[model samples]
Target: MAALAAPTWRMGTTSLFPRLFSSTQQTRFALPFFPGVTLTIPIGIQLGLPSIPSILEGIWEGILKAVPKKKTSHMKKRHRQMAGKALKDVTSLCKCPACGETKRMHHLCPHCVSSEQLLHSLQRRKAHPADIFSLAPTPNSILSASGSSSLLVHSTTESTFPLIQTIPNAHKLGCHHVCTAKGGLGNVAASVGFGGEIKIWNKSQNKNEWALDWEIPPSGDVWAVALSENEEYLACTTSDGRIQVWDLNAKQVIQTYETGARGGGSFAMSVDLSRDGKFTASGHESGAVYVFNNDAGRMVYSLSGLAKPVRAVAFSPGCKRLAAAGNAGIIALYDMQHGEHVGNLTTPNARPAWITSLDWSDTGDYILSGSLDGKVKVWDVTRGACVATHSETEGALWSVRWLPKNERALGPGMGKGEMFCAAGASRSLTFYREATGI
Candidate 1:
């Protein structure tokens, strides 16, 4: 047999127990090891695994660098690099709605409108709402009352929407309520204010701009007003709890209904006449909702059950139900026929948020409400459940209205194409359309 060479170690300690060449020879071999050191690992096999010597060396270097550094400049440079990377990650998520362009989501999109300077300008000029008591919308124009003092005619021509013409000082004193009949004719506009007076405005457009033609003096500051579908009879609710119906053609008070048998003078907040002009609904601050039969000319039902001041009351398009909501954060629905309380709708974690505005879809399929909590919700009338909720701000929402349906395309019940508008303490109006097809 050929002789075999033995392996040799130069410096490091070898295992204490070494294997012998023959079974008869001793197997134990005590190699020199430093004091306090205790390790005996075998070395000889060759397995095909990648060596990671460089990885271990890099990890050791990182550990040494991570310790407290003495220099302030180097630490600041490292932090700035980390912050730059974070900003880059955040800019990736913002996008624009109108053009589908990527932009900071929290910041306004530049392509849509100039928000930078306009926001600051609005802040410098504080809230100066002229106490608009009545606002009636038409296809081409809008009639508004200014605190029982003036009549302002606004043009709905600037956008696809309306713009205010702001006729200054149309009334001798501030007016409480002003409204136009169903169709925009010349002589049907009405205004009432603080003093026991009512004035009618007629637009006689000759060669120049149309101007007010005549004025009528009625009994009180009209707190709320409504008009018949035929535009013949005008109904105005006074602060003293009397709803006076006027003959627009005759220019005289036809009849008056006394509210507040549930203890009057709780200021009628809202009033509306049915589409058929047979029933009139009124909501009072005393939490009382009264429905009267204008055809029979008497009080029909005094709907009860709401405990808080009723701020908003709306009759559905079909005049089948009335929804009233207020400081209680609960919305109560009443059957118009029997004046019986039907059901209530409320948010789950309902804030004691005052209900400010209400509007029903033309089909009576949905009822939209806006509240002090700045939430606009769409309620499914048939199911009596909230279908959609949009909370855009924490400011009070003052007005919510559904745009009249398009008669050319499909009526209210047939298609899903619909639009609504909301405006409030934020000083900006928002328009929303159905996001999906019906």
Candidate 2:
């Protein structure tokens, strides 16, 4: 083999190895020995063999340009998908199969829970053969009044609530109202009869029997009556709308607060004395509610709002608020200090029904109301909402009372547990307890 001569070449601008070698013209290589068989090869091919790194880099750049970079984080991508799914779920609506009512698909049926659990723990018993007019609960007993002349007493301390006694012929005409003081033993009870008379009764210390202690002759027709917590005083509403407070210990009239003569003295329908014995409140047939100051012996505030007859008036346990209800089908709450109407509690789409009775819980956190539609409602005062409702009978309910809180009888979820008794035209006493299981 003969030696071959090297040739210089310029790199072409379009070649991948433009810096490694330059080539613009083609060159030919010649073999020395064979004169007739001289071989020729291009200079660019010879120089390109040593430029493998630049060719590889150009291929990698081409691949990267064809692919895309990830711009979104994994968590951001997942959150966007979830938000879209939730929006779809919220807009979707469905009908409840059981009641054929429209409701949210993923939420519980409110109507079903309210109707089924309202009276879930109720028990009924025939306390009076006739319609029960009033109920008064002591620390250990419940006194009920009916159209019958006798007053029935039931022991509440026992689980069975046995019939303890009956005051036969206590009221020649049926008793319309009955009330007891807060103290259990040695406390007195007062009753107003249809015959326009008031009777005071005391329990026997030795025999534990109730007997007539005294009577207040009928100066006027007494329609309703209430006793102080200490049993030291009694307040009664007369047909002439006169609120008269009597000293039980002295057995004489102490003060008379009169509702001004509207329509010849609006008939006083209901009266209640504060447990603290500081105030007296009366509801009249002319839709008037008057709160009187006992110390000053005068009407302090004449509350207005209900345009229909006022049937029930009660002061809260704290004596800071008063609730009044009647044929208006709504309850008006009043602040005692300023005598201003604070708020009104009304049911949505409620029918026209007379609210006959009202009572406050021991903590004054809730109010219990009985209506002529046979529905009992528990009102949450602070929230201004009706927390529970029960309608077991179509007959009218005349009276409802909250039982004294029994600490020993409390169950789970029964923080200061609650129990109430209701009586009415159903001719049976219905007892309701908090549904702790709920």
Candidate 3:
């Protein structure tokens, strides 16, 4: 800077003088000229000004103008207050310690709500652990066979969860399933054991609990059982693929249907008797569902719709529909009258897991399903759409049933009807009711 060169100027992020033409000698030769234009003229000097960026910017803006803007959401805002109250926190609702979310109070937990509401409506509303083995609902109490060879009776309506009575050595090893009359009016009940022995129990008017009414001779390992609505007929399925029907009064295997075509697995997961006791259905591990006519004493339909091992099967209250679901994660609804596939209820992908339990609402207006993913979904059969879904737990849900809505006793707004009960590996029972604004 001996001579102190003229100070350079700078514009925003660019240089007033380009680096390539920083020297006066370079700038002189860098200027461009139009034909017949003299460099000394004003027009020629003005044209030499930098204008490449301006032209590029104009082209860029024009391209941007051709693109469209995104639209805003038009959905209405939801009211937080009512939605909050409708779901009562059920974290503390159940008596068992293992019951987690089910125990929270006031905020209805989805798993418990769906399970309790549906199962509570069944004629013989009952729940038990897989290890418990047997369940029988009496008018005023429920009898269960514990994993032990003993049986426990619980009062159905007591304020506290009280054990009414116990029977020791009720089973040689352990009973697997049990059945009672539809109404539970009489004290009669039936149970099937691992030893293939079927035992009937009855409570004397004077006795506090049930005593062994009779035990059928060994057939095979008893896997499943069902009782007629009238409690006059008892049906039991064995590992050998034989369905043994017993006359409760005559106390013998009146008829036996050889259901051998279906794959024979040791576990016949489910057995159901139609409301009218006209039909009996058995779901096997081989993914085969069989519906038998109790009146005809023969297999009426060997249903072919489902191929996955059928875990649960139920008949509608009117005996017009039969539903079966299992590991396939599909709920198949069949018309009992026409023996045609009526429709299918699909589970959402978020909860797209195995379906473990299913039951029809008392009116048959809705079908409730419990899945291994711990969700209870209420499906509107009339519309073939899911009406509501409750996330009950993160654990597998073993059972769900619609409760008998006691409409007559319900106060205002409790319109939908009775509640249901759900139970599973969680070792607790959850109750749920249709949302009533009141």
Number of the top-ranking candidate, with TM-score as the measure: 2
Is candidate 1 or 3 superior in TM-score? 3
Using lDDT as the yardstick, the better of models 1 and 3 is 3
Q: Which lDDT value does model 1 have at 438? A: 34
Q: For this target, which candidate reaches the highest lDDT against the unseen true structure?
A: 2
lDDT of 1 by residue, 212-233 (tens): 6556665555666777666777
* Least well predicted 10-residue stretch by lDDT in candidate 1: 1-10
Lowest summed lDDT across 10 adjacent residues in model 2 is found at: 1-10
Candidate 3 structure quality by residue, lDDT tens digits, 1-438: 311222221121124424323323212112243332222111111325555577799899999998989755434234443555566644434332222433333234444344544444342233333434334555566566645577767654432335668777877676666667654355778877677788888888886668887888786667777777777888777776677677889877777777775545435677788867788888887888888887788888878777778877888888998999888888888888878888788855654688877777767888888888778777888888876667756766666655444424232223345455555554445555552211
**Residue pairs that clash (backbone atoms under 3 angstroms), model 1:** 147-174, 147-175, 148-174, 148-175, 148-176, 149-173, 149-174, 149-175, 156-162, 198-218
Q: Give the TM-score comparing model 3 with the true structure, all chains together.
A: 0.63
Query: Which lDDT value does model 3 have at 267?
Result: 56
Clashes (candidate 3): 40
The lDDT of model 2 is: 0.79
True lDDT of residue 352, candidate 2: 64
Can you give the TM-score per candidate against the true fold?
0.62, 0.69, 0.63
**Per-residue CA lDDT of candidate 2, range 254-341, in tens?**
9988787642678999988998788999998889899999999988999998899999999998799999999999999999999999
Model 1 scores a TM of: 0.62
